[model samples]
Target: MSETILPELPQELWRAGKLELAHGVQQFLQVMRVASAGLGQYLAEIESRGVKDLYGYGTTISWFADIAGLSMGEARPYVNRAIDLNPTRALDGTEIPPFAPATGAAAAEGAIGAERIKQILEILRQIPAEVSVEDREHAEAKLAGLARDAGPRQVSDLGEQVLGWLDPDGKEPKDPEPAQPRRELTLQRRKDGYWNLKGLLDDEAGARTAAALEAYAKPRPVDEFGQADLRTKAERQGDAWVDLVDLAIACPDQPGTNGYRTLVHVTIGLEELKTGLGTACLDFVGTMTAREARLAACDCLMLPVVLNAAGEPLDVGRLRRFVTPGQRRALNIRDRGCTFPGCHRRPKNCHAHHIHHWADGGPTDLRNLTLLCSFHHRLIHHGDWQVRMAADGLPEFIPPQYLDPLQRTRRNTLI
Candidate 1:
């Protein structure tokens, strides 16, 4: 029982990072990737058979989380993946089913759990291979309701729908142009308290950016319990998100920021502070990163740009001169990370967004400055969404017409 230590490497490692450090990081990443894949498979197993045999079965996700060394929310996905990767029984109701090979169904549904896998597989088999993830996901969701009562008739109907999806004669290959490329995000709030966000990003840029933000907003590990005499939905989802975040950060591809819990989120009221306007902080849902909150709090959450009426572009908020060391310390308590609608990013992943920028005649007080993770900040700067202060001084989000034809503006109290 002796301690294990690596032989010392030569000093004067490159300024970027030591070669040994780089190698070690790479090795760790490889291990993590392999582990994540295996974990997905295991979660497939758990979803079918309740965690009853597992130590934390009928209780809180916290117990399982302890074993994974992840937050309760984070652990849930592993459990779900275990469930989703391979359902307890395959379509024949005999041996558990596995996704059709190479369809990538295992990876996606696994994150949600076996139940979702079943739906995904059903939808995938029905649709042609060419269908997009978004379309497939939507179809799966619609069909999910029949899982309990699925019979031969339903199965046959699904097969027909899939055939139609495959051919879709006379239609262009289902590739919708990538979402609009975002260049900047400018949000404007009216005196009525509604805000609008608009911006731009090219395909690769927008996707990568979206991926980065989603890396944090995934649901936590709370999926095990359910409405049928299980834990509350909030608790289950929260755990899934927590677990997902931990897993994402530990992975090789993540931004590798930290201190997610410490950042401060401020919701400025445009009405209270402005002329009868409102303010709101960012929203953390689906994906969130704890690491992003630690290292670059200022850059992580607060968005620096704004827009005016007539869809004009303006750069009002700037975190550079505004975030004092002491103020940053206060900010940690104020903003956990990017303060965008339906986004969950840590401070390190966010930027110190200002309701008003000092450069644009904005005040440095908490009344104006807030947090927004990089993506949301950009969403604030470029996307067709909106953010503004509420009566209570909180951030709100309004989806673009494409996401919701109704184009409703929404708000959240949590940053």
Candidate 2:
């Protein structure tokens, strides 16, 4: 390992690092960029050749992506660029500015020297064990500037200088920015047969949603709570719905395009899960009647109410469903929204999914559904993933048969 350079302290006596430092940092950066570009180039070449093979003539783009760790969307473009840059055989049998046009490698072509593309690879072989992939690329981009001046001797010196600065013993990085917001919940069943729950949202939604749930869950006083009548299930539910609507309107929502809020989901238990071996199914709250329940059992993420052997309400807490306002809120929340995983769907990009579908016995409760950008929902409905409520009354997923024989399950605990 070499040494780290300190910015000149005018009063301090000069050290010998001055010459070695700048040149070293510069050298390491250049060598790495060439290599990464080369890998990209190599993959491109293989794909071009592979696609034309008779046995794979009609191979789907996705099939190629699965092998390359790229999304089909990305693989297609990468392949195109590689074919255009085709840099495999220079007279000296090395890369000849293969990606110059697309990547500005021409100006850099002359900037790097001595380390011929072939020589650069040899130097890269001696790259320090601790030199990271990023370091390699950063050095490579800078090295592009050296395309006309550097030689193997400089690469060795550069390695020492870089390893000194990057992995300077015990000089760890500052805390990094959090990738996703912190959100989580715990649902525990008490001996009393009721669930005690707690959750955390990014900001006020956490408190607001919790308070709203608490209000609905509060014990009633001789049926004096709001406009509900326990004697009639419809009246009681109607009252509950009014409370839900009132809460949705008054709560702070980031608004949506269609004059409403984003949809919320309240996934209840599912029937297929209860069966264990058949296809998955869901039941939305708006149609929780037997007929609706029966139909919803055909889709994914729709929550079917769970009943005991004697068929009594289990107090498993209802899910929020989307009403028009909720939909507005949903659209607002997901302005550039699609709920399909990794989808970038906007308002024009989605369909409001019934956490419980209308065909199934689901309610129009905000907790009963979630908004899914179309592609993902279709994937859910027709692909390998099966989403349903778990024993805990939240959404869980079972991967399709094609993904694994072990049946890996996933959970989307965010409500």
User: Against the true structure, whose lDDT is highest?
Assistant: 1
- What's model 1's TM-score? 0.25
CA lDDT for candidate 2? 0.46
Query: What digit string (tens of lDDT, one per residue) describes model 1 on residues 2-38?
Result: 1223344446556446667887665554454445555
**C-alpha lDDT (0 to 100) for residue 213 of candidate 2:** 53
Quote each prediction's TM-score. Answer: 0.25, 0.22
Report the C-alpha displacement of residue 235, candidate 2, in angstroms: 48
Judging by TM-score against the true structure, name the best candidate: 1
Segments in model 2 whose C-alpha atoms lie over 4 Å from true places: 1-322, 327-348, 390-394, 411-415
Clash number by candidate, in order: 124, 66
User: What lDDT does the true structure give each of the candidates?
Assistant: 0.49, 0.46
Q: Residue 189 deviation, candidate 2, in Å?
A: 56
